[model samples]
Target: MTTFPVEQIRADFPILQEKIRNKPLVYLDNAASCQKPQAVIDSIVHTYSHEYANIHRGVHTLSVKATDRFEGAREKVRAFINAASTKEIIFVRGATEAINLVAQSFGKSQLQAGDEIVISAMEHHANIVPWQMLCQQIGTVLKVVPINQQGELLFDEYLNLLTDKTKLVAITHMSNALGTINPVKQIVEAAHSKNIPVLLDGAQAIPHMAVDVQDLDCDFYVFSGHKLYGPSGTGVLYGKQALLEAMPPYQGGGDMIRKVTFTETEYAGLPHKFEAGTPAIAEIIGLGAAIDYLNQFGMAAISAYEAELLAYATEQAQQIKGLNIIGQAAEKGGILSFTLDRIHPHDIGTMLDSLGIAIRAGHHCAMPVMDFYGVPATARASFAMYNTRQEIDVLMQGIKSLIEVFG
Candidate 1:
C-alpha cells in the first residue's frame, strides 16, 4: 500500500492555512461540508471569468463551452460513483432536493395509498422528511428500522420490515450523526429479494469511500457536492436507466422538455427530463474539478487515511474524563460524536472554536438519531482526507481545556 501523503494533500486546500482566533485552523467539520481544494476554486473562477453562459439553450460559443463543461461534470460524477451512464445522472440542488424529487415523482407514479416505505431510524432529516411528506400526500406508511445502543442497525429488524407492503427502501449508506456505516450491500440484497427498489443517501459515504451503484444494485443513490469537497448548490441523483425512464419528470421547465405547445407539451428523456431550469453552471464545473482532484489520491487512499485519523481521535477521546463517545458501531466512517459530563455540546463547540478547532454542534439534521441517543445535541468532530494527526491533537487539547474549566 502506498503511504498517504497527508501533508501534501493538505497543501492543496488553500483554506487549511487560514487562522481562526489567532490560531491555525483545525477543520474537523468535514461531514457537514468539506474545504474546497485550490483546483475546484480555480475552475469556478475560470468558468465565470472566461466562459459564463446558460447551457443547453443557446447556440453561441460561450453557451456551447459552458454546456460541454456542465455535461462533462455529469460524466465525471457518473465515473466517480461507477454509474452505468451519464444518462442516469441528474443534477439537483443537493441530496435533499434529489430525495424530494424521487419522493414526489416516483412515489406519486409507482406507489399507492397504504403502500409502505422502509427507512432506518439513523437517516438524516433530508431522508426522513421528504418521505414523510410523500406519506402525507399519498397516504403511504413510513416504517422505520431500529438501531441498537452501538448505533448499528438491527439487521434482522430491517429485513423483517421488508415485506409485501413495502414499496421502497431508502436508507443512509453512512450515518451523518453516528458515523455508522450500514451494511448497504446486504440491505440492498434483502430489499431486492422482495423486488423492492433501494435508495442510498450517500451524503456522508461519498467523500470517504468509493461508491459503485451497480455493484450495490441500488435503484437510486444521492449525494451532495459540498460534502464531497465540491461547490455548494450542486449534487447528483443517480437512478437506474429503466427506473428513470419509467418515472415522470421531477420538474417542468426549459431544457427538460422536448416540445411545448399551448395545448400539448412533451417532456424530454432520461437525465434531461429531471434537470430543469437554469442549473448551477459554474458550480457544476467546479464539482467536476473536485472529482478530478480526488481522483489523484483515489477513494481507497482517502478512506484508509481517514480511518487511521478516526482511530487516533477515538483513542484520545476515550481518555478524556467524563466524556462519553457515542456510536461505537463495529464499522464507522470518520465522525466522532460525543457528550461531555456537565457541559452542553454548544459550549464544547464554542470552546473548541476559540482554539481554532472546528466541529459541528447540533442535532446534525438527524433529530431522530439524537432522540434515539436521548441527547439534545452532540459535539461532532468529523475528519477528512486533508485532516492531520496534529489537528486531532489540537482538538483533544481544546476538549481537555474545556473539561477542566467545566469541572
Candidate 2:
C-alpha cells in the first residue's frame, strides 16, 4: 500500500484547521458530504474571477476558455471512473437528478406495463422514490431484494427476483446508512445474464473506494460531486454509449437541442441531449479540481488508510457499554452506525456538537434501513481520506461522556 499522508491530506482542506466551540472539529459526517480542499475552492474562485462565461456555442475568448474547462471537466469525469468516452458522461444536478433522468427517459420509454425493476433493501431514498414515481406513471413493478440482519444484500434472493419480466436492476454500490459495499460486479454479471441492464447509485461508494464502471460492467452509474469533495448541485451520470444514444432527452431546452423550429425540433447527441439550459459552471470546474486532488493521493492509498481508521473505530466503538453497533457487514466502508441505550440519536448528535465532534444521527435518507434494524435512527461517524485515528478517539471520548451524562 502507498503511504497515506493523512496529515498532509488534512492540510489540503482549509476547514479542517478550524476550532469549533473552542475544540478542534472532528468531522465525521463525510458520508453526508465531504469538506472541500483548497484546490477545489481555488478552482471555483479562479473560474468565477477570470473565466466566467456560458459554455458551448460562444466564440468569445472567455467563452472559449470556459468551454474548454467545462468540456475538460467532462473528460476528467470520464477518466475518473474509467468510462468509455466523454459522450457517456452527462452532467446533472446530482445523483438524484441522474436517477430520475434514467427513470423518466430510459425507464418510461422502454419499459412497459407489468415490467419489473429490481432494487435492494439498502438503497437510498433517491434510488427508491424515482422508481416508485416511474411505477405510478407507467404501471411498472418495483421488486426489492431483501438484506440479512448484518445489512448485506441476499445475493441468492436477488438472483431469484430477476426473471423474464425484470427490466432493470438498480442498486447502490455502497450504503450511506450502513456502509455495506454491495457486490456490484457480481450483481452486474447476474443482471447481464438475463440481458437486464444495471444502474449503480455510486454516491457513497465513489468517495471511499476506487470504482471502475467498465470493470463493474454496470450500464449506468450516478454519483453526487459533493460526496466526493466537490461542490454541491453538481454530479455525474455515466451511461453506456449505446444506451445513452437510444434514450430520448430527459429535459428539452437550450444546449439539449440540435435544431429547433416552429414545428419540428431535433435534440443534440449523447450527453448534451440530457443537459438542458445553463449548468452550474463554477461547481463543475471545482469538481474537476476535486478529482485532481484525490488523484494526487491516489484513491488506493486513501481507501487503505480509511479502512484502517474504520477498523480502529469499530473496535473502539464496540467496547463502549450501552452502545449497539448497526450493520456489521463483513464487507464495509469507513462508516460506523450505532444506537445508544436510553439515549435518542438526536441527543447524541447535539451533545457531540458541543464538543466539536460532528456526526450524523438520523435515517441518513435510508429510512428503510432504519426500519429493518428496528431503530428510529442511528448515530453515524463516517470517515474520509483526511480523517485521523486521533479524531476517532475524540469521537469515542464524546460517546463515553454522553453515556455518563445520560446515566
Candidate 2, residue 53: CA error in Å?
0.5
How far out, in Å, is residue 58 in model 2? Answer: 1.2
TM-score of 1: 0.99
C-alpha lDDT (0 to 100) for residue 374 of candidate 2: 92
Q: Which ten residues in a row have the lowest lDDT in candidate 2?
A: 1-10
Candidate 2 error regions (>4 Å): none
Write one digit per residue (lDDT tens) for candidate 1, span 200-237: 99999999999999999999999999999999999999
Clashes of 1: 0
lDDT of 2 at 100: 97
Model 2 alpha-carbon miss at residue 90, Å: 0.2
C-alpha lDDT score of every prediction, in listed order: 0.94, 0.94
